[model samples]
Target chain A: MGPALEVKDLCRGFGSRRAIENLGFSLGHGEILGLVGPSGAGKTVTLRILSGILEGTSGTASICGISVASGNRKIYEHFGSVAENHPLPGHLNPFEYLQLRACLKKVRDGRREATCALQACGLLRYGKRYRIGQLSHGHRQLVALADAILGRPSLLLLDGLEPRQLPAVLGELPIRPAVLVSGRNAAEMADFCQKTIFLDRGRVVVDEKREQRN
Target chain B: MFNFFALLTYEWRRISRTSDFFSAGGLFLLLSGLLFLFALLCYVGKPQTVSPFAFWLGHGWPMVLLLVPPLSADSIAGERSAGTLDGLLCASPAAVLLAKFSALLLHYLLLWTVALALQPLALFLASLRLPFPLWSGAELFGALSLLPLSGALYLSCGLFFSTIARTQAQAMAATFVLLFGLLFGPSVLLRFLPACRWPILEDILVRLGAASQNGWPDRFLNFGTVAFYLTATGTILCLSAVFLRSRPFH
Candidate 1:
């Protein structure tokens, strides 16, 4: 079977400023990969490209053999992403936002999926009727976690989350999809990922593999 | 599409809860009420001269159009600015844009329809048949039929700019400029372009101007003009979809 995610020679730019340059990487079906970099080091851009949120200027990315270049709805079926600064509609209550996400992903039973994910994330303690904007930042992050975890997607992309929150976020996942995380903290990446790629100036500077320290 | 309808539901709730809608509708009704009262004072026993129907036809559409720019200026642009639009990428841009267009258009129509019904209430109290006359089937149907298309056209114009603009305020400003330009530009432009006053050119410009469109009663009844507005509405909506799809992900 093909890798859960396959990125080859990916290049992205904003006018004269190149954000990512000729980057390539892949994540196997069960492995969790972490992208570690300082700010402006292209970690977020790389994750965006892999998730099909941003169009790469050159080269290709695919999830489960579906190309991001196609920009087709089919490519999103196996994927889910929780972007940094993702605007969870502030006016929508937690349940409403989850239901909206569930519906957007077209899960068979949106309410059930939304409820299950919310319960798994322990967010129901916050009250489903509370507006997302009224929730604490950590609680809001849980809302996003619930959104990504609902459909049990095959590939999950998470960007800019706090290092300490990783274990809590991952523990709520009902299905262990191939997870890719982008963060500025190397120590966190080292602790969580089976493999970690350190990027600087849009290119990978280090690729490290570590056995699980069980 | 499932996405469109789901988005439609979400948008409907957002629109209802946000409550700027009721404020706009209340403002509209207040102005209409003032117009009726002023008509009663200025043209008393001269109902033939300033019938409520004719008076409303003159000011109603412009009032509705005035609300259009601000109401839609934020539709997509606000979502984009708020970072909410990034989460919506899974749904096709067409579905998202169409849902915004439909939801706003429906909200406006319901508000205006209630206002339309009120004209008769005011008329009944004053003993006048000059309401947009729900009594006459053909006349009422003729008057009401074009409202949705016109509302769609107005909302689509705002939605297009909202998607294309960077901020909600900028979107609203652009929509107002474009709307007023289309409405009153020709007469004003003709003054500055006196040197190029060719009859055929002037005639075409005038045909495209508010002289033919701002007169709501006659314009709505004219099949050609209605078709033109509907076509323009469709064209603008298609352009909105394209602009939405082309928006860069930050």
Candidate 2:
């Protein structure tokens, strides 16, 4: 089988500022890769490009061997994304928000999946009554994580989630999905990631397997 | 169809629950009530009897037009500022814009309905002194026709502003400026020009401004005017969707 997600020669720029330059990476099925970089080092930008939220200036990305440029709805259906700020509709409670995501993803057994996802994220009790805006920052992060995992997407893209929240997420992340997470802290990146790719000024500076790093 | 409804429902819930929505709605109600009371006092205080209720109804719809746009100004722009555009871009850009526009249109419709409901209360108060037709069924229907069209026009403009704006405040300000330009700016310009110059310049400006071409007050309901507004709205909405899709979210 092909890699779960493949990005080659990804270049994205905003006017004079280059967000990412020739960023090439691939993830195998069920692999967890940590993207480590400083602020403005293009980690979030790369994740945005891969998740189909942002178009790169040049290069190609394929999800499950299907090119994103071909208008592959299946690719999006199989992928989940969580950005730095975790922007949920502030009016919706956790349960309503997850349920809406499940419907959008066309998940089978949506209610069951949403409930399980929330419970796994330790957010089941706050499920029915709490709006996203009312939730604490850490809890909001968890909600976004739950949204990413609820549909059991084959590929997951996460940015700016702290290490403390990682335990709640990683401990219960669904199987068969290749996960890519980005952070500025190398220590936190090293903790959960099986492989680490360090970036500097929009280019890859380090790529090491966890075992090699150890 | 299910996806469309689901998106619409989600948007409605999101917008209606915002602090901005409540504040705007409350302001509209307060202003309308004050205007009604003022009209009543003026009529009773006058030597010649006038239909205070009819006067209020005449002024009500135009005031609604002024109010609705501000309520919807930030509909899409807020999403962009909050970094939610990335998540929304996961869906088809066309669908997202259409769904948001529908939600805004629905919000204005509800506001219009509330304004319409107040007409009866005004009429009942007027009935104590004189017999007057406060609202004819035909007039009500006519005004309703224009409400959706005008609301769509404002919403399309707002959507375009949201696509280009970097911040919520900027988007809101742009929306107000555009709306004010469309509604009152032409009349203000006409006031400065002489009558001979006004005829030529006013025609051109009104056509360009998306104003009702038929006449003032009653002419607001003409089919051609409604079509013109709707067509403009559709064109702007299409442009906004394309712009949003082209840029994506980064």
User: Top DockQ: which candidate number?
Assistant: 1
Q: Please state the Cα-based DockQ of model 2 relative to the true two-chain complex.
A: 0.53
User: What is candidate 1's lDDT per residue for B98-217, written digit by digit as tens?
Assistant: 888889988888877777778768777666554332245543455466556657777888999998888899889888888777656766766676655587666445444533233334
List model 1 lDDT by residue over A156-193, tens digit each.
Answer: 78886775666675677766788888898788778888
Worst 10 residues of 1 chain A by lDDT: A161-170
TM-score per candidate for chain A alone: 0.93, 0.94
lDDT of 2 by residue, A76-160 (tens): 6778878887777788899888887777677788889999999988999899988888999888988998988877788888898
| Candidate 2: segments with Cα more than 4 A from true spot | A13-19, A68-73, A162-174, A184-188, A211-214, B37-58, B122-137, B184-226, B248-250
RMSD of 2: 4.4
Consecutive 10-residue window with the lowest summed lDDT within model 2 chain B: B207-216
TM-score of chain A, model 1? 0.93
Please report, as a residue range, the 10-residue window in candidate 1 chain B with the lowest summed lDDT.
B210-219
DockQ of each: 0.64, 0.53
Tens digits of lDDT, candidate 2, B162-211: 87776667777888778777766766766675777557566545543433
Which residue pairs in candidate 2 have backbone atoms (N, alpha carbon, C) closer than 3 angstroms, thus clashing? none
